[model samples]
Target: MINDIALGPQNREVKQYLSRSTRDSVLGDLGKVLAPQIKGRGTLQSTFDKHCIKDSSSHRKYWTEESFFNHVRGSYSTNVISGATIALLWKSFYFYAYHPFPLDLHRDAQIDFDAFIRATLLIVSQCDELLGTRELDWYWRQDTAFFRKASFVRMFRSIAAPDHKSRSQQQVDMTSSLSDAMDVLVMIGPQFMHAMPSEPQLESVARKLFVEGPPVAGGQVVRREDLSALIRLLLRLRLKERIWGTRCHFGNLVEAESGEEYLTEVLVDTLTGDNSGQIVTFQQLTGAIDLIPNLLLRFQQLWAVLFQPSDAIDKTKPQVNEMELNSIGGIVSLFVPPIDDDSAGILRFNQRDTRLTLEATTQVSPDSLDTSMSRLSRGISDDSSAYVVIFTDDASTSNTVIGAFFPIPSKTTHMIFQIQPRFRILRWEKTELSRLNLIKPDAKASLSEFAASEGSLSSNNAPYWIGNPLEQGAGLWVDPNKGTATLINTVGGCYTEMPSVGGTSNTGENWDVTIQQARMHIFTVRGSGDRKG
Candidate 1:
């Protein structure tokens, strides 16, 4: 025998008891204060109210037509929504719109919560135009009543609003979208090695990211408009699937109303991998995509062992601003990555966050790049977060470098030790960005320093944090006053290469580039050790 779930009269008592227990556990001292009267003294009855069972007004299973339409912005009146409008919310509420309607009944059709949700899953992910007719036939055979309901809804809406046909028809045409015809092929671009989505297909779906580019050049080289569009879409998809977290996590990244835009610009700039103001070659696009996994954008992590209402803004406020929603702790997010194995070594007590800005300089910090690490981190409430240091260069040179120091900050020594990430040094020779990290034990110095001496960065009474460079190790030394960086360390240590690069420092295999003009930035990660409450 299967167990019932608060249904039937038999299991009703169990559900009522469960609900009472749940309420008692959460009510704390308040439960005692207002206990008797609310609980009812004589012959109290349990009600299976929809509001009582669900927390959200628009919960997929619990919502009525009226509540759900109001929950979704732009959904407008209940049962007055079109498929195109529902499609717009697919990213945020895919589950809500994909379970009710599963076929192309009619474009101008007015749909209830049931039809929109079913149609969504069918259109976006599971769509296979090759099998369309057969599947429709199968679905019609499976549920003839469902088809009848859909047809009646469409017929009624058409009769009520005669003008809907012209307006809705132009909103989503085959030429403007990846729909109705040959499906499942719009996303698999050439970079992923699937059948490359046609240029027409790309222009149809992702033309927004394009910058009104020049005419087509020739083979392999596409119009500036097309390349930009393709790159942005690829970057957006990878980030949605890889770097950015769930819709629930988006609110935490914001510091202000424009916080999401600030973070989005940072993410988009980082993925572009080019700021020379030139069209990124096909090679650059692929290289940037390949680098996504290794390119980690992190910050000093904030850990909350317990949650409190005051810790977040007053969510109950009648008009909760964008900053308050989708938030954790006090800070609302724009796009925060999930905490997982990829976070860092040391468990970090916190991790690191590094981002790019809109200007040529990918180095601008959200805060300011002051002289002292402690001073830079002074304003950050969460002790485990990273320091911000932005450095922008001109259009002449090409390299962009971002680095952070990870470890629990020592109040005693005031020193920062390298823990999670190995050293990363990037060189922009012309129009490309390349990286070099020295992790192998055999990585020794290649004598590129003529005016400078050899050894390592000083561990003496320096005010800010510095990595203790090995005699054979490499390090990036930033001199804020000069706005220039040396090929190898001019003060002490010389530059070394990654061990995986296959040649030794003394073997004459080289990496560092001498820049005529340069700017530097250093972001140090400080753990909230004594600060962790």
Candidate 2:
């Protein structure tokens, strides 16, 4: 049944090459032909006639954003064009026909689309924009998974219901056109949680899509599938913003890497399991742990757990089930501090020493521990508790702690902490320091006397400041008169400190101070052994 042309290898290669090149040339010509038709002027047939003629392919102009929008509009309005044909045209031009532009052009498209929506809103006198022709078409063509015809109908109803009694014919016409377009777009398209939306416009759209109930259309009640689709879209958009929105300020740690890669590594760390029995070092875990506090700041609720050497120390061996851990102690116990702090008034786990002591004395069956941990795990998965964990070796330093939004091996050598979908860790920039209350009026006190006070020690009795005595710019200072402690910068004369309350003085000669540094971290207990009375 083979054709004579396919009998020879050389003939087959020649035919394949010709087919690819001819396809490319045809698409390029199509782009030039359709570019002018999208401007809402010529019909698709006229544009095809003007440039798609056999000899008219000589002039190959690049497709611009304006032209792309124009084509999208014109193709949708063309009565002669089928949805499948329009989709094919878009795929051809978008992938191979159009001149290559910067990836930022996609962003520019979004901006232009947004502006178009705003203009449409003005015409309709509605605060919310309609999910019209352009939006539905773009969504269907760009990401068909998230496109739902029912959702589009519901959104249209919400935006089309005008508050004004006197509706203009132009507004009526626009709505009618968009409605027809959406009907076709959704018919051709396939169907597909949350940090709050940061952008005002996104927030408004999200509220409309998720919070507001879907409006009835054609005397039919809104379907659950439509509501579900809207929710999915809202969550996806918010998550997209979180991951790609900003750089995470990891103090000096994020040097030489793009924020996007840094985020990717953190996420990888969280999901990775270390089967090797080697201890996970501080340096290895620092980058991933550095993101937890920022994540907490972004998403208020975080579930966390701590694992010690004795609790499944050999991570190489399959670990206990999460449900097992939950049965013994609920996951909430991890965040709820056994002993409350009055001054700082923040819920925190016991000190490293106390935790170590409890682990040594406590005796529990592995089965019991597993059951407890598993229940705790369920709470986290069910959104009843936060979902993050911490791990520490028996001989680890007491000064610093690490936390993550995922479970890690008990005795893993290297851990990869991935940023969870619900949270985003942004780079804490120096400019943002002004927003925090880190400075106060100076009190009359000698720096030497303040350094000698008991307040110089941290709550855990660790040395509050660590630096070289011989270095002038690298030491700790406490202003006794001002009731504040400062860490002298190693590279600069500036010091960073928490401002003291009620230390203000009206003296014209008051010392002016500025904050130079800050750090944020999240911590939690691995086991409830320490909580036993």
Candidate 3:
């Protein structure tokens, strides 16, 4: 019956509908026409020869882009395209069985539809692992569900016949090859939405596909990368669907404490803009979060660390602070109370934000060592010097010779700093000005007297911590690998070999920052609440 499916001439129809230059290029390459002999060698072979997949010589030439369209197109009428689409969905669903995703997601791993479908089928046919077996079975059963829904009938009804006069001609416009494939998915959605096979039905399909082959042994193993890719695809589609509406709601906020500090956040849509949202102060955010899922737990951990108060804030400076929240990978949604009187009440957690505190940290050591500590702040320096200030051993790290201050001071301050690694301190510039002013807390000192004293208001000495090419830390470090400064940072508190911030390496192994002259930019993932800055 696929032969009965009357898709128009392949070449003419395909060129007219190519969505991107990449697709057109692929088709152009296919048009040049290569012999089967060249195509046959692309198949991968196993070392032990146990899984040597001998390329079916006939199928080898079909690797071209045009060939792909022809295969699916030819299979259109016979229910083969629908069947294959279901197969793809089944295979895609296997990702959920082995690798769970956020419930709100709409796309599967392997953002590339062809690659995803091909990989799923190949894995089902070859992989003997548990994950593989479960995947194959999952897809096979999904195929059966399509039959129960009678989706083909529904699709045909909606589609216009070639010569028929119809009012809804726009509805069945499968003019492009891509449209044809999408049509198949549109028809197959109902089957995928159904429950998995019952015992009897499972037995039925198992017997039918027995000739095709058995499933892999351990089921499907979905890796984190796969999950990330899948989530990205779904996010793109959700954006396409315009699912993100204004007035997003972040679910309940969860408060967590690390040592003496507290960090908190409520699950909100990842797309919400911090600058655009309602400005909620630190006082309002203290008891706002609610714990719901394991995802929220992981999210809370990251938020706690990212929001920890930093030592870089100078109580002297005033600036309009903003907060940015991003998912580790994709845009995820959280439920919040409905905003209006709509019958169906649910919250969309797109990018939503409120005013919150920005925290920074600074580390201090004894001045005898001539060592510098990196301070995290909102400001930048071209020389990449650490903002180091020497004090009489009594002042808090917050007191400095030069600092950014505000007209109206706030109770707490957060400053951030980035360290540019070099082997030694190339130079140093220091200045001391007497009669510096002070802005000490709970002080009655007049403006001029406060400026003259050595108290918190004093700004007599100005020192710039310059990069020392020879000065190195005790930990691991490296300069640019392949001309790029090598930098290192941890992931989820776990060490993994990643590209050197300034170097090039395949393995993401951790490198010591002090030992190597690598100019690495380090990022800390953390969260913070309003109190105890």
Candidate 4:
């Protein structure tokens, strides 16, 4: 993540992270099209994709520019950018998926010079992985979390020597950097109000920030090159206080569960390239992490725990609940308090169609089918809230669940990717926005007539389920009221190719008839705190 050519944190005339020459060179071919700051979305119209990348739209609705600015008032710039989080900064920065964001974020807008520089750096830096600008990735399809944390470091530098732009490195004072650190923290917080620490504690965190780089002037000041690194480390330490709304030390979360340990061990070994084909000792895991020059900028984006303290704190073990750790392919879903014995997870798929995945929850039991699936059906059938469909397979090696999530609910009779409820052709993972949203077919077509079928392709209402009904392009479907379901993928290209999902070829595999898939489960994914389906 370090820039070899423009390694001057003291040279404040250029971009903090990306050297000006590098920023300009990267944007040369693109010209002004990918400019960083733009007027606004309405201006962009249809060419919005050129501006913002929208791989996944988890937010059902959007807050107006006015409303959004209000939410991040202190931290976000409001005047020059003027409700321009996406326009000015986001393109070059990492859009945090710490929460759901607006779906209509991409807009046709204009761009400015600094904005352009940031955008170009963002695209060029990770050009090997993500192609262009994009929204927050909920599923993390491409391992990009903390992907650009380094960029933040570049923007921030020597708060001790705050005046990086006007003065030369030789003239700058680095030991005095602590002056602006508090202001930056306050800007990023409603911080740990309940866990407010004493002034000495904050100073300690700030002073220790300059961990790397050579000490300047008889060790009294830190080097300019290390200033950006300090900003990045500071963010990792503080930003979560804003998002998670609780002060967390590693000890609190780790004591609770296996968590991402299996996932952690797997990725760390990949980072360390130790692939010993044996268990990873704790020393090896930590050592591998330490060897990486920049923990935040690893190409794999594989580093899991970024901000562990040098010393342990909070030795008390908080009361923790059992949670199900489900992982498959590049996806990992944790059901806190654990999913019920009956319900499986949810899986939504496809784009731009009325079709959405039918969902299942970790709440409720499959054995009580009479009330479960029926109520889920009635819920979507009646309530007009957004919903998501979660599809899971028990047979897969890694137990990965596939889904497309859209929390917004619509009225049109959209198509559905079959996943069943707590029980229906396994509860066709879906929400009944309006009376099944099914187009009645002329006369009763055979099960082979899926496209023109009399009702939805799959439903958790029981009887016949397709898709999760477990089949390939079939017209007929049947659920035996048992714990199993069979699907035949004859039309082809039905399943996504995931080796962890037992996918053999680069292309999708077929059900080929003998499919005895496991029973369906259900759970609700909402902040309402109710886990019931």
Which candidate number would show the highest lDDT if scored against the true structure?
4
Worst 10 residues of 3 by lDDT: 236-245
Model 1 clashes, total count: 35
lDDT tens readout by residue for model 3, 360-424: 21222222222111211111221122222211111222111111111111211112111211111
| lDDT per residue as tens, model 4, 258-326 | 222343433333322333432222212222221222222221121101212212234322224222222
* Each model's Cα RMSD: 19.6, 25.8, 24.9, 21.4
Arranged by lDDT with the best first, the candidates are: 4, 1, 2, 3
Off by over 4 Å in 3: 1-243, 246-515, 520-533
Question: Residue 509 deviation, candidate 3, in Å?
Answer: 17
TM per prediction: 0.30, 0.17, 0.19, 0.30
Candidate number with the higher lDDT (1 or 4): 4
Q: Regarding lDDT, does 1 or 3 come out ahead?
A: 1
Task: Find the 10 residues in a row with the least total lDDT in model 4.
Answer: 238-247
> Residue by residue across 217-276, what tens digits does model 2's lDDT show?
221222222222222211111110011001111110001211332233223333121231
Q: Which runs of model 1 end up more than 4 angstroms from their true locations?
A: 1-338, 342-401, 405-468, 471-474, 480-533
lDDT of 1 at 434: 11
lDDT of each: 0.24, 0.24, 0.21, 0.26
